[model samples]
Target: MDEENQQAGPSAAAAGPAGRPAKSELVDNQNFEGQFKFGRLVVILSALAFTLFVSFLDQTSVSTALPAIATDLNAFETISWIGTSFLIANTSFQLINGRLSDIFGRRTCLIICMVLLAVGDLMCGFAKFVVPVTVLAGIAVFLVIPQSPTSQGRMRDKVKMIDYPGMFLSLAGVIFLLIPISGGGTTYDWSSPLVISFLVIGAILIIAFIVVQARFARHPTMPFRLFERNSAKILFAHNFISGVVYYTDLYYLPLYYQVILDKSPLTSGVLILPLILGFSLASAAGGFAIARLGRCLPVIRTGYVLWTAGAGGRIAFGPGTSIATIAGCLVVEGVGLGLSMQPVMIALLSNTRKEDRAVVTGLRNFLRTVGGAVGLGIAAAIINNVLLQHLPAGLPRAAASQLSVLLDTLPVEQRGEVVAVYMRGLHCVFDGRAAGDGA
Candidate 1:
């Protein structure tokens, strides 16, 4: 009997007294590492990494291209929508995408997303106007993301599990909210009935979304239980603030270079290299440090401190700021961003249960993208309002609205004055950024 029991081995031994598998044994059974050979594991990881790279590239590439796009299309006032629309879609579909991947296989969802992205890019190249092109691109990003298979139930059952009320409410709320934010004081007056109506409707829809998620949904897209923990709340807030700062800088910095510093679009892109390189290097370094130290809080704290200082430093940027000063400030901000990014995600994952990890991850990304969309809208409103007030009064409405492309057209003497006004607007933006970072 003893020899026969020994022959049964560890798998049988992993059962509890009730003859149920141990929790750890169940987890081990689900481990992808145990199923794949070393070479196969490498290929899987590489493919996933490449997918992530493509998504990130699409997001960041717009920053440098914005100025040129505005100039080419003569749509300076509406250009923010290009980025905002992408983020809005990202924020809206983020959670649903996870649920969708559960219903359809991961491979199927990925193929669809990639097809949309490719088609969207192709249309953008041939696009003659701004708004339509923006819409196309926005629609395209259904979000090129990957999800793991969760083959739990029948297709019909899986489809029924989706939070339809949560999906429509959130999507509608985001669109209504963003329309006013992006257009108020530019396309429409702040006090316009159109703006006020959208704002009120959006708030109501968002509140309704929360209520549905909390009280009604069978499988809530955003589980309220996650926010019950204080740590999760803090991490969510941190990610939101970081996204605001990151996208604000990404979008505005290139405009500053091209408009105030008189640099070409290509040159502006090149100048931002310090920030990008520093971020990449610091992210890698932070990962290694966390692995070595076996903790994340220290790195996170240091990152916030550096980021705050860097944001404050950005306040000094103007027409006369040196390239060296700009580079140094950007480096500091980039390092801070890189250090802060992964650690927070790691902390959130550490705090969450394994089963809830997917939802928590989706929520994190959703909040960040929401922050970015809101930040861009706020920045656009500030700059456009200031420009409306300070731009040369005699300029035509068309020219004034298209000032992003009017630098060359303005008289030599007026160029300096226009640049000065732009700097003032940027100052307000940076001030708000510094305060947000400090908070």
Candidate 2:
């Protein structure tokens, strides 16, 4: 009887490893560790790192080269459009990529994106004309990015439902808003026909997109379910706000260095290294820390304080701030950015099931990018308005326009007086001062 009962007990507890007991395996996370798991983590990190590296290099390296390129190409006015065009195209594509990533896989889409990036780089390196290079670069971006969600594996179940509607809304909203702002200060008159057209089109599309997402799609991309939680909304806002702060810092610091500190263009560009490098490093660190600590809120709060202080602090202190102060600010901001960014990414993932990760990521990225675009325009507007205000009262229109023309002609020193005037005007405009009628 005992022997028979012992054999019967074998099936009593729910199955575990070999039917020992189910609870043991459930309690221990040990089985989850292995080469395969670690390898997947590595691959994800590698992909993300590559994405950041390529994008950063492209943005930063160009500033150093823009002057030289413009001088040789005689496209001073055209140069502004280069950045504007890139932003528009990049934003537009980011929206679509999120949807495509869901249909294809993230890993596959990313590889294609890298290929596009490689081609863009090749064209930029070789092309004499900006048009071909810029257009190709845009196409490359379109091919490379897929707007799918990132998974810390939270919203896994909702994956299949994420696709088009929300993306179109975001794309339209960004395009319309960005066109005017990007052009308002530079490429076209603030009120130019081109700018107006973009604004109008963008607005109409965004409104239509929202309607489509709400009324049409079976599984609309924007996960309204997540927003019902306060934390997710906070996280989204943090990403958006942080981006704005970052863009402002990135745009202005170089101007301050070149204009106020009297550094060369190369020097100005180099001076910004600490901030960008700090951001990249901090992001990696933050991601690691989140995995280890498993405490999301504190890390994010700390990050917020540091980034805000670093960015907004300068607004209060002014140009006389010390180098050490600036460096400290950069490091702190980087830390904050790392802390907030990764955790938010994690939060969105944690909040949802595994499937919805791509959708969440796409939505988050779109908002953050939009915030960045807005920040760029705000910074530009500040500089432009300042220049307009500071313009000396009776400067003859002819001389002023000549000065503007010269400034637009070529790079410093390599460019004749015309280039010099343009550089001076750039400084004057950024510094929030107008050219003296005397000069």
Candidate 3:
């Protein structure tokens, strides 16, 4: 129907004797290094793994420090912005980053992303004011620059270039939608004039961005056409299904610890280790297992099933639940996440050429990350609504608001009781489960 649409097919050149990359994807079916240079491969993988660790650590570490940041900046309303800003920056440009890598080269983009991420982290660490936070966040978003690589039988290729226009439109679209949603209740009233105006503005921005991409943006970041890649489709499937729970973990786990268990910010950070550590170890393992097994279908299915189970456990950990019980659930869920997460990625990569990998992988990761954020937001709202309905009259009125909000308003003494309410509320939120079930 459109010119971009007509040109949207996978690279016709993918059918190398050694590999079958989709159209426009230049996977030369040739392994220049021959027979896996174990030493060099290990070094390369280690760098990638280190990057993953730093990226993930930055992502999670902030949760632990949020309270301090909030207190220091007096940014009670902008609390959500801290996280939302980064997500918007990181996810919005993911497709663009990918296209850029495919067109220019992955190395340059990745290095740039890493440096930008480092700068962002440094800025976040030192951020004293809201403007600094926003500015730094905008700059730090350069971290998610890797493109998704397509896997092939017996070989793989990475993206050689990057797409700028596609990425900009997509980034704009994500930011436009999230600006209002992220700040809805806290910064502005959901139904208020300004919030509603922002909502309208975001919609228009996204609509405009999409129209431009579909018509213009050659070498688009998302290449809406590239969804034709089977791996791309499956990658999304993995994120969507896994995302429901992956997001829930990041969304509710912290609140559960701080709000229910009444743990200090530092302590809350320690508590999430089982989940984060478990996932980190398992993801690496999953990659190895997938590489050995050379197929992803089984791993994907298994991970999905386990993830659902983990979600069940998380949904069940309520106010009265045993600390040990919650911890146990985290370990189990972490293992499941680890086992499934990397394997699916490997499986997806297994089917793609190296050139497309960065963008595709970035897109997949972007969706999953956003999914987690959205899930967290929904869980927060649900928990808040439930708490409001169930909070005993004796509790402070301010204590009855959303967890993040309430934490900011009340002093430490009153927070314990509020935390108990959150735990119990989450219990009920989890499909009518009681927090006292563990007792």
Candidate 4:
């Protein structure tokens, strides 16, 4: 009886013919030695992490260089496109890449993504316009990431596993949701029919997509069973909120250094290094903790505590805040980010059955991307609203409109007031993020 039960246990988690595992058995079953050589695992994960780092660096590193890029290219009017284009492409391609990874094998999809990302970055460095190049890079990154070890095999009939209907529905739904969130209050009015229509339509399509996944698809892109587990639902929410906190600090801290502290762009980048250092250390430590302990929850909770402390601390920042203070806060934020990021991903993968791993990976990324987009949009709205309501009436439209680049150039008498306006806007953005962290 005991032998029969033991045999029955692993069989429940075993992969079906199409390469997906049943939801009943989600625990790790493969022996470490049979699954991966330590050396090979190190090499593959290192490469995959580097690929993700480059993708993130492409996003975060550009802010410090933006002023120079705007001046050099004479494209200040279109500057927002550099980031927005990337976000749209990155968010949209996640599901498609997840499906492709399932069909073609994780290695194949990753290689294609890396090659495309490399080409796009190289082109951008050569003074090419960034929108298209960055869009392609974003698409590559969304595609090139790793899948679970169990998801590595090639299927017999890849065509059957590709769920075209679900893919289209998901893509359309996400793009619709993202378009309004990205463009509202920037390119169009928040209340405009263009925005409202897209929001409603996007919500409906997403609902429809979920229904179809539950009822119809021969091979549902997102297996409904994955979220049936309560823990998975909570994890997805955590990922979304983390995205908000991560990008808020990343985008704004450099501005604080440049605008409030009177540091040059190069200097600002250097100053942010402590935070990056903390992130690297904690990320490595967190990964080790997961491997050794075989659990992620403890590390994840500790990360939240640190992240909240660091993010909330920044709310007190003003024009006179010290670089030391800012640097310390950044370090805290970085450590929190590093600790939380990898463990959550590891946790998500661990909870999912083998066949669902790639899809869950894509879903995790999609939520993060959406969370980032929403956070940035809210920050932009707050900044713009504050600037409009508070800026001195006498300031030139050009200077007021392009506040970041023009603040230093304004007359000495007005420069301080302009700086104050910017400082207020930054405070709102930071405070909002802190509140999110606490929640």
lDDT tens digits by residue: candidate 1, 75-186? 7777756666666656777766765554455667777888777777777777877566556556546356664324344556557777889989987987898778766766
Could you tell me which residue pairs clash in candidate 1? Answer: none
Off by over 4 Å in 1: 1-30, 74-77, 139-142, 146-149, 395-401
Cα TM-score of candidate 2? 0.72
lDDT of every predicted structure (CA atoms): 0.75, 0.59, 0.61, 0.76
Which regions in candidate 2 have their CA more than 4 angstroms from the true location? 1-44, 138-173, 189-194, 219-223, 291-293, 316-325, 393-439
Tens-place lDDT per residue, model 2, 190-307, is: 7778888888887888777778766776556554665777877877886676556555555556545544444566776776777777776777777777778887777777766666
lDDT of 3 by residue, 1-439 (tens): 5665345434434454444454445442323567668898899778877776776667776656665677778875566666667656665665565555554455666788788777776766776775455445444444543444323332222332233445555666677676666666545567888768866876776677677667875445554654768776867776755654565556456766666766777777778888887777777777777778877767656655655566577666666778788777777678778888777777666566455566567667767766655655555556656666766676644322235545656767666667766666676555422121111
* All models, RMSD in angstroms: 5.5, 9.8, 6.8, 3.9
Cα TM-score of candidate 1: 0.87
TM-score of model number 3: 0.79
RMSD of 2: 9.8
Give the local distance difference test score of model 3: 0.61
lDDT: the better of candidates 3 and 4: 4
Model 3 regions lying over 4 Å from their true place: 1-36, 134-165, 229-234, 291-293, 350-355, 392-417, 428-439
